[model samples]
Target: MFVPGTASRPPAGMMIPYTEQLIFTIATQIPFVIFFGMGIRNLISRGDPKALLFGIGGCLASAYEPIVDVMGFCYFPREGNWVAFEAFGRPIPIFVPATYGWYVGGMGYWFWTVLQNPKTTQQEFQLLWLRAFIINLVLEYPPIYLGIYIYYGYQPLEIGGFPLWFPAVHAASPMVAATVINLIAPHLKGVKNLVIIPASVMAYGMANAGFGAPVWLALSVDRGYHVSYPAAAITALMIYTGVWIMSLQLLPTQPLKINGMNGNGKSKGLRG
Candidate 1:
């Protein structure tokens, strides 16, 4: 996506040293840096333990993203020549750094804060999630629709032996990761975790389809695959509606801690 206008074709992917890659990768993934930075700021301003946890979550998510990319484990095209991990006899994906940063700096940390404070009955958290989801859609939609990444000659992951949705379904990786983190974080309930799974899936699926990334490339870039806009459209709608419904059902139950005993001098799980 960062190719300069004058450069019609990409250079042969090469592996720079980790130190060099670190500098460039950080520079390129600005959105991710900002996201993590915001998490830190929230931690200091609000002094919410959850905010700090979210910052840590961002770092962890950022770390894993590159591994997924490097191993070609999840999906999407890589940008540079393969870098191999010495212990593992395989090459790493080129887009690992940027994609990982995108996850942590953008959504991972934010999702952590929300999950830890799910008891928030106020509209702020709800509205924030909605806004974040929308921004993600807006930023991601066009690359797939226009086949912009494909035109750059990167080979994305294939589904059913065909190129999956443009920009690739793996774009939902962070959403999936954050949801998993939420399930394990303190104060979460078994039931809420179960409910969040499908809801998140729906949200990501709808977002991918609705904004852009039609079932097939509209311009016949991959003519082998048949276009079925109806199927994609319907799936997206179902996912969006499903996520919305579940979110409503999972009402917040915040302020989970109790400070002391009840009138009977017995332990009570009630907020002071």
Candidate 2:
């Protein structure tokens, strides 16, 4: 469905063929689904550090959204009043375009959370942002060149030229959001694995699907931008943020070793 904003069609050349896009979609989501399921299992088994990581990563993913929502640049097509939106009165609607940036950002956030464990203190939280930026750079450039994805706002000094700053914008903003979450994680209270896993997973899955778009359109009319696209991107960010913090909270609580006694059945670790 079209939202209440300007009905700018996605860049013509940027649109992948439906069949190919579908294949890519399935390919992309399958691994995430598997990993998230594994994360759920780990969370159920009392504690899994990676599961916690996913949870926290999912949560922090939404950090950049409020600004994007406010900017009127976001919109969608609507049959009714074109100016009215549903996303809680925002100007645009939730759609695929809105979502693409943050989905990738969540992955970047996840990498940083795992690489820099606060327990070790080897790297400060700031370094995590740096690492996330670098890794995203390494990952996104090749894909763009290979036509795996195309960026919309990447205009260079010349018209249609490669924008030097585009990748940096994509990588740095989310990393900054993640860094904020990392800084605040310790101060937040009542963190637990149980809270982390399910919430993070649900948020990511739903949001990535542009969960808010239909609802937003249904509610008001003119809400956000690209009804389905932006919805997916924001969802990814929200999920990442949730999962990232969840990981932080659960990491320290995991047991180093649950030792059972030898054949003697004497106290070995936990049994002892």
Candidate 3:
């Protein structure tokens, strides 16, 4: 029932002090940053260039969330809910981008992990989508419950105060990142930092713009909330489903080779 581009004050009773908000922001973002850092290091040390590239791609892709949020295409309503610093014309927490990086990187790593499992069968590919959904719920529900942020201004169907389409959206993102990275990995065998890094940013942007533009437009223009939930949900589902199917097609059938040493710094097989 919220309107895009319109600012709203937090409900009086729900407002938390800036200090508390900062604490929450730091608490949530640090773990993701650490985890992503560790994963990136492991990938790099092992010379698993493919996994490293995709992980970075996911990080870059997720960074777009904050940009869109600040432009008023979406609303976070974090002004009173947290200590805010202005960027791109909106008061947002500093950790917003980091949290997104964590999410996308974490999810990308997850998808990579699943694809690399030696015993995984083609039938198990379907499980990637399921894992994406579960991960989405796990990551989002806590923030919603804590009132860290909430969608406003003409959201679609929701579950427990979060948009129902979110899990699908979240699920689609890593797939898009993975598909882009996988398709381009061969050409990017060397100088990946120079080429793949920028390419990943552009690919992520294009994927989000292509898939998310309709949803954004639908939400933006229909300030009256006239867009039916079913219509919106269907649109989201179509986009996500297409991405999921494309990912299944692009994913390598063979188990991936892990590059780094095991716990004792000893090399392991592809199953590692």
Candidate 4:
């Protein structure tokens, strides 16, 4: 029994117009689609079934958003003309999940790329985390600013009206993805469709535990459905960072020399 409250509602004049939303939605999705396609194609061509499976797993993980939307944990305002559907009482744009898939899949490919290079050190991992934070700031902040989606129930510590920990959550996602990819790499290389089971579990677990739990708990308190910003923010940071650390711990002690053929194939040696 969570209510998103008024903060979740878009301010007057802030809601994206139907036409603009449609245009933006399509435009944004195009690049991600292209990247995902290229990544998949490259994996296929390079005979890297393990990487391909990881990418597919990432896409599947992104589908968890629909459940979040339906549960009233988050809101994506509708542009009247966009294709719409309902699940668990939530209205969603068709393209929203597609974009999410691209994002997650793209990250999975990135993780695969990182693993393929020579041995990675803690310093390199830190740099990669910084890069993810910056990238999320660039990509995610705008949508929040534009009212593409509103955080209704919980008001975690925010900058520019969005949770401050969001970028960190974004940053951590690839690490979790990397963990999943590396864990299944060996088995997936030899088994066809075997990735489907573990990938499904990881996707669902990560989405629910990593993303959904913190928000849910923040709203569950006596304050009703409003976000306990501090608690929520802390929970997000902890979960995300913890997962990221776990991923790092789980990484291979020695990096595998992946040839340059797949999407993440560019050889960038670990910087000194």
**Per-residue error (Å), model 2, residue 85:** 13
Better of 2 and 4 by TM-score: 4
Winning candidate number (TM-score): 4
Evaluate residue 243 in candidate 3 and report its C-alpha lDDT on the 0 to 100 scale: 55
Worst lDDT run of 10 residues, candidate 2, spans 153-162
With a 3 Å backbone cut-off (N, CA, C), the pairs that clash in candidate 1 are 13-81, 14-81, 32-105, 70-92, 70-93, 119-253, 119-254
Question: Which tens-of-lDDT digit does each residue in 1-272 have in candidate 3?
Answer: 23445443235354434665667677767766676667677667976554455446555555566555532244455446443344454455555545555556555556556555656555565566667778778876776677666666556676677765656655666655555555655566556544545555665566566656556666656544566364466667677566557646534555344566555555665544
How close is each model in CA RMSD to the real structure? Answer: 11.7, 13.8, 10.2, 9.4
Global lDDT of each candidate = 0.41, 0.40, 0.58, 0.57
Better of 1 and 4 by lDDT: 4
TM-score of 1: 0.41
Residue 136 alpha-carbon offset, candidate 4, angstroms? 2.6
TM-score of predicted structure 3: 0.70
Better of 1 and 2 by lDDT: 1
TM-score order of candidates, best first? 4, 3, 1, 2
lDDT of 2 by residue, 1-272 (tens): 22245343234444323444344445445545555566567758855454445434554434323333323122222322223124444332222322332343345346446545545333343345455546546544543444434433212221232222333334444443344445455543445423433434344334323323332332233333344334435534554453355345324453343365455545555532
